[model samples]
Target: KYRNLLLPMHMAIRCHEYLRHTAAAQITYKITRSRSIQVELGKAESFRETLKATQGPCNTSKPSMLDFVNKAKWDAWKSLGSVSQEEARQQYVDLISSLVGTEAPAVAAQPTGSTKGFQTLLVSTEDNITTIRLNRPEKKNAITVEMYNELIEALDLAGKDDSVITVITGSGDYYCSGNDLNNFTKIPEGGVEKLAKESGELLRRYVKVYIDFPKPLIGVINGPAVGVSVTLLGLFDVVYATEKATFHTPFSQLGQSPEGCSSYLFPKIMGAAKASEMLLFNKKLTAAQACEVGLVTEVFPESSFQSEVWTRLKAYAKLPRNSLALSKQLIRVVEKEKLHAVNDAEVERLVERWLSDECMQAIMSFFQAKSKL
Candidate 1:
């Protein structure tokens, strides 16, 4: 009884302070402190430290450091997902507030120098280019609901603010791997129906935003693009990559269908046969190969990729902003309704896939594979 009272009282006070100061005061702190969960937390903290250091840009060799960091982060998050979310709300409120502090730091004072409270992205504007980076390299830059909201916010800013162009990229080794499985695992008690409802709503919002983005959107594929990320490349005005970059669509592999309006876009962009190879067989495309196939605009040398890409983009951004916007709009205006319909259909099908036995089996098989069962 004392434990319950103490936690809530402490949290209420702190949360009041938090709510007063910042909006990202939302805290999700549910877990059982089992040995395995603690171990996962330790690993997650370690990866986060490394991720903090990898804020802006860093050089890389053959197998880049980002790749290593991404894998470690994925492993950590995967382990963390094993944690159950059945604890009392008051306990969580108190524990989270105590650990992370009462007041969430203001965006202007973020350690990453980002002017936003993004859990899975690093957002900043320079020379009219709003660069929204996928910050969760630990999970191969997967998209979660929070991350989706952040991305939309960034785009909204780009449309309203003085930013001339917006660029999306990933940290560590990936541009964006796809939707994070961790998001689906959070509602264990609600089962497949819960997963479908939450994910379908989030994904539909994401697809709508992507389809109707008002500003010129560029994708900087720093290393690899996979799943929804790969499909999203079809929507970007331009996609640039490094020599070490790769592209893959694993919809069928995951017992899911194409997303990001790729069901319509892929066939047109890469031809019917190649699209089948990618969607069905999970064919991975190297940077040069992706360039040849029309998915990637250019593949720069790994050493100078970042500098070259940003320099070119900054130069292009300096071009008349209205001209750039109008030109892009002209190119894509015809397909707006088509893409929207496809997005709606895909979301419907995706919900069905989520509830299907095949998807459940595939998810179970994945766990077995990870646990060596």
Candidate 2:
């Protein structure tokens, strides 16, 4: 833990403590031994206990490697290039497994199905519950233009595949870090103005898919969700989140506006003040806070989040399919007209925003910083 915890002053103290632990215990860690990050064999057998003892203040709030990685913060891409969502997710699962002293089951390829051949996502259906995982954990599951296009196809496929419900979740520790900036670097032959128009249309169409989803869309907030990814939660029928999950919409900070009809629904569900803070002031909400304010359906402990969310989803999938569909449709009936209008409005606003000097300033400033690096 000390190795990953990033402490400068504790080196010598850690060295002394490590030596003490080594004298008391038999094994120093496999590679590290600065402070004997090992448990006394007879003192604790459980992984959690051993971890707690080996790393004092095991749950410290200090900046950590895991946190930085999970948050997708990097100086540049070289050290941890552009990893696919699936790979990033596996890295997170592996990290958690290491912390708990167990090898997590690798997310294996499902037997051949419609989900096959996808590069940025994993699709599978079991017990009538179709799951669409944002599989690019390598970039913190950041959505690329291709991913957005693929998701449109995946959701449409699920709608017709006799799947009763579709569950959307991130592959690993982070739900989504939003749009991959690389998507912008590839300007089409027409230039950025043309690209901006196309981007707005692409987002507009995708948001429509969310608005008109034939089946219930459930979001499993396995970890933090950022940017446009958080905006779509408003369209989810139900949302389950782990304690570690956070919903951050930094639109104002990033020179964007709320998409996915969040501008319409967030105020209705969480009140205008909260919505303003999230959309305009750059607010971040944790799992419990999200649930209390109605952004999340339920919150579960991180240790058992996967089991808890899937168990309920599978059971829900067993209910009468038509009944679920009809129920969802009926509930959404009142919002049909409003959703369409807001989606278009958001698109118009987004197009104007892209052309605005404010947004250009933000983009230029960001790229300038990157260039300096």
Candidate 3:
């Protein structure tokens, strides 16, 4: 009888603790109504926290004030559902529109001084050029989540910075090896779908950023440009790769499809057959081969690679930045651009294939083989 009587009290205390912890966590609101509601809810939470900290165990049958507030707030929210539904939708649309209309925040504006989300990409302005470098040579400058975010963030910042006439490279040894496979295993449940969506969005944003950018986006591929690195090369206005440099896309080897609209861009740069061969066979190309395919503008000797890249960029920088940017836009004007469609189709297909038994078995087999090795 005593234990049964204590059960409700124990349950209420646990509930109180849970709600207190939940309130302590940072919350995000997507719409104006949600923000307003969250603010009100936060105030109620403060009251509940205060009560929880101060109030002694009640001997009475009456409910506590904190419990009363929680139930009241929840009931009020439920009552307002019909009234808030349309307003909530409109606020969301407005928020999205506002975001789309405003210029993206500059990398320089960030207090963190990081690009995308990487702490490794060091950004510096030299003369009229913005130099961005991947600082993680220890990992062969392999693209991690932070690195990927930083790349896009840096590009976005450069795009908005009018003083940046040309963006130059500043990484040692390797341009980028590929996406970090170790990071791949850490992805959460439904991460693949989330990544696909995010990748598509990032690709679209990058394309617009590059196309409408006031300055030339030059790429100095100092070494290997593999996976996302190679696809990103297609986004640049001009690319200079060292003789020692190589480019590759190993999507097929990983049981995934091409990304960053490589499907459309590669075929446009190289011939359709060559693009198909590279993507399907997971082929690696020398800098000279990349140049031959019209994917790269020039290949310099490894000894003078840095100097050659800067020399070409300096020549480009001598031209009015707007003129160079306009020329790039003109050159690509006739190219049948279908990046978004291709990205969506590829992602849809990839998700379907990723869920397939064949792909699962292949991935499992590869991991097993790797473990043995």
Candidate 4:
């Protein structure tokens, strides 16, 4: 459906030029932030392919081994193999659309045929605010593999949309119950090794979206948050919680290491000793305690949480959008590279943990205990 919206080759060329100029302009003011090296490389590769799709392949001899950038760009173009030029052009246009804030909605309002709408989230935009609410109340909004993909898509859209602020919360009483353990039980034909690698990659992309979010991201924690849900708050610009809310990351209990760049941000936010009590010892903190320790910005009484938080957020959303976004980019620029590195290291460690006997045993025991209950 979105393919019909592709910009022509000449327009795509102009778009690339525009991006370069905009990036240069923003850099001059120190408001432009660096994306992960991988994302930047991918964009470069896509631009190269777009050129090849319009113009013929590069005329020069193959890039030498020492020319890392040229070699990678050449390889990316070569990877298209027999794909049609039109297809390559379409792919390049899609990439540009995402970067230039022209992406279609993550889920159409009335998707037809095989297109699916969001099943795990309720997304709505109003008054320059996009609220992405986790909707699986029956399961305390636990994140399944499918939800992970939807979240990444939603965040990407919200980041590129005209919204001035993006808010994340949950329906019902729980913000999130953490990862759905069932994700581990359904090993595919390729087995645990393949599953580990794929899951790690997916998780990496999930966290990357949060790290790279352009607009102000606010977390409204109405209830308990666990595991990745708790860890991810570190990426939010501000977090408001109800008196009922609690933050917990029982990673060690599940034989998992920290993720969501929590390993780095947590220490910075709460100091090494307090961060260790939660990340290393699995200490759960009440809303007041979390705020005291710097994990949450504030805690409101449960009775007034919704009204109070929304009122403040609505006021924030009315400010000059560009100023807010550019200021945020500047603040985040310094830590962006470090966050990406921590994310990579954390995901790598988690992949190893997921494949380990200790993690498997711990999970099995957890299930066993649940069954007996």
Candidate 5:
């Protein structure tokens, strides 16, 4: 479904570019599969309008009636009558700029300094704090393979930077919905076994960064978090959440086991039975519940969550950086080796799970159910 919508829009953009009579206007559209359905439709309409205005009209001689894809594109293009090319160009630029939002540059090729062309995350530093934000809000900040790599790199940079505090959060409503299921479908040329191995390796390194992070690692969970996103809180120094936030690890539902050192840390933090309820039985915990279980440091009222968390963080950042770093390192030193072992074990187990029939069936069922919706 996503592919069907994307291919036509991509081709339409290319066609528009090809038909351009002037070099004054050029569009560099960054296509993302994570776009919401409404957003996708809105962009499609805009694209059609832009194409019609700039190109004058769909080539009636081309896109034969039997060519459904091209025909649909033709119909869409025909529906929007042509306008002045200059007007269309301005409208297209304005629309793209608006969609890009203030967080990113309007032109896709524009560089985001220090972030080094990160596609899935927003990394920024301020007031002695380095923030790594999961930016895919339309998909509840789901972590894709690209996101995982970007996160690892971001954390590594943050660890070495002058920032006294490193924070992780999400853009928009969700803190994170956890791994994008679509990540599994993108198997490399070596097949599932190879993909599993490489993914497991990546997961290991991702978790290890958190375990060995030098600065104070904070999680600002503004909304619901799931799977590895929730599990990773075990390695964070502090996890501040909004009152409306929730933490969930639905590993069993996906026919997968625990990761991010959760298998070892969850029981240690919340007690075996409570952890079992979450890790084994897929029980979701509210912000209060999570705090009580030691997964969250504290919960703030949604009305003031941001102001309150940042106020404290800024104050904390004012303290002697080395002292704070040393203190955190001292606290984590004992568990560093333990977390490493747990991470390796979990990754190996996950690799096996990824290649299993049960996991595949569960993922297929999930997609089937979603398609029906």
Candidate 6:
């Protein structure tokens, strides 16, 4: 039995080396012992063999330059047996580049019978209210690159179409869940700055649309309004959330920072202490709590959420469009000028925090535990 002890000791070293390239891999090694040590070692060996086979000359297809860069980075990580601070920086740059380069593809515009023209957002105009449902429910109403572009278009149309007075809701029961995580893996290996710029541009554009739109923007939060989904609500004129709705920001949890100018808007809307609690502490709020904090205007039963929202929208619609638009503009103007600077500062601070060892460790730990579960 003592003779077999050397085998486990050897397995541990092999497992450690194998996991060296991944940020989350070390957490697995830490959480599990002996048997896992052997298993991880075997998996590492398998991975090495698979990688070798894939790179062999007989495989006619060439690996893309970005793919090769990632592979080289991973190999270097394995050879070093640990990621240094410098290596972590390079990895962040690579990861961000990839995220921005391969932003989610656009959806084809659909022809709608409504006079608003073709749009990705499904619009239903009843009386003075326009309900624009985010049509991609299969993906849980997750926002894609194309959806962002289309959202701007929809807002423009809503502004121009006099028949539509109040813009009620866009997404379905789920609302919008921010960028898809699956796409996060495919971001290119360079151009991190450009990527950040583009992402910021899209978000800024959306904020402008929300703030400058001529009528009230009411959000109907039916489920989890996560990441950007949660932040976007800050731009809404009023929000009606179901009792089932929950809001959370997983920026620190996801190895990223708060985006969509929430940092500026949240503090303005909810005050410094409350905003800090939500953004810094990553607090998740229930619909009732959100209402109390002024993030949500009211909470309604999930069973009748749609009907209730429509009732509210119709009430808003009854107001003179010009008067409603003017009131909205005045409120926005009072809060204006400060939001842009605050948003920029917040993102800069968040980016720094995201790059810190503490945040990195937290993110890696969360992912590792999540993977195991």
Clashes of each: 2, 9, 5, 0, 0, 4
lDDT per model, in order? 0.72, 0.75, 0.61, 0.82, 0.83, 0.63
Model 6, 1-373: lDDT tens digits are 3123222333234433444586534333332332333433343333333233222112233445789764653563344333444453344334323333444455554334354543456876667676677766677777777777888888778777664464545455676666665432334455534444565566667766765677778787778788887887887888888898888887756667776678777887789998887787789988898898899999999889879777767777787878878888888887666766666665566546544677657756766787998
User: What's the lDDT for residue 221 in model 6?
Assistant: 77
The digit string of per-residue lDDT tens for model 2 on 117-139 reads 57888998777888899999878
Give per-residue CA lDDT, model 3, range 259-285, as digits (tens): 666787888889898898778898899
lDDT computed for candidate 1:
0.72
lDDT of 2 at 250: 84
Q: Answer with 1 or 6, whichever has the higher TM-score.
A: 1
TM-score of each: 0.68, 0.68, 0.61, 0.70, 0.69, 0.61
Stretches of candidate 4 exceeding 4 Å from the true structure:
1-116
In candidate 4 the C-alpha lDDT for residue 332 amounts to 99
Q: Poorest 10 consecutive residues of model 4 by lDDT?
A: 27-36
Q: Distance from true position, residue 234, model 1, in Å? A: 0.3
Model 4 clash tally? 0
Query: What would the per-residue lDDT of candidate 1 be over residues 1-373, giving only the tens digit for each residue?
Result: 2222222323244433433343323432222222223324333443332222222122222344578965654444344332222222233344444434533343443233246667777888777788888998888888887888888777777677667899988899878878777676677577769879778887888878888887889999998788888888898889999999989887777788888888888889889988889988899999999898898899999999999998999898898988888888898899999999999999999999988888877777777797884
lDDT of 5 by residue, 1-373 (tens): 4333332434455435643553323322343433444446555765575575457556575588789977876788777665766676656656544544532333443232345458989998888888898999999999999899999999999999877899999999999999999988998999999989998999998999999899999999999999999999999999999999999999999999999999999999999999999999999999999999899999999999999999999999899999999999899899899899999999999999999999999999999999999
TM-score of 3: 0.61
Show model 5 residue runs off by greater than 4 Å: 1-116
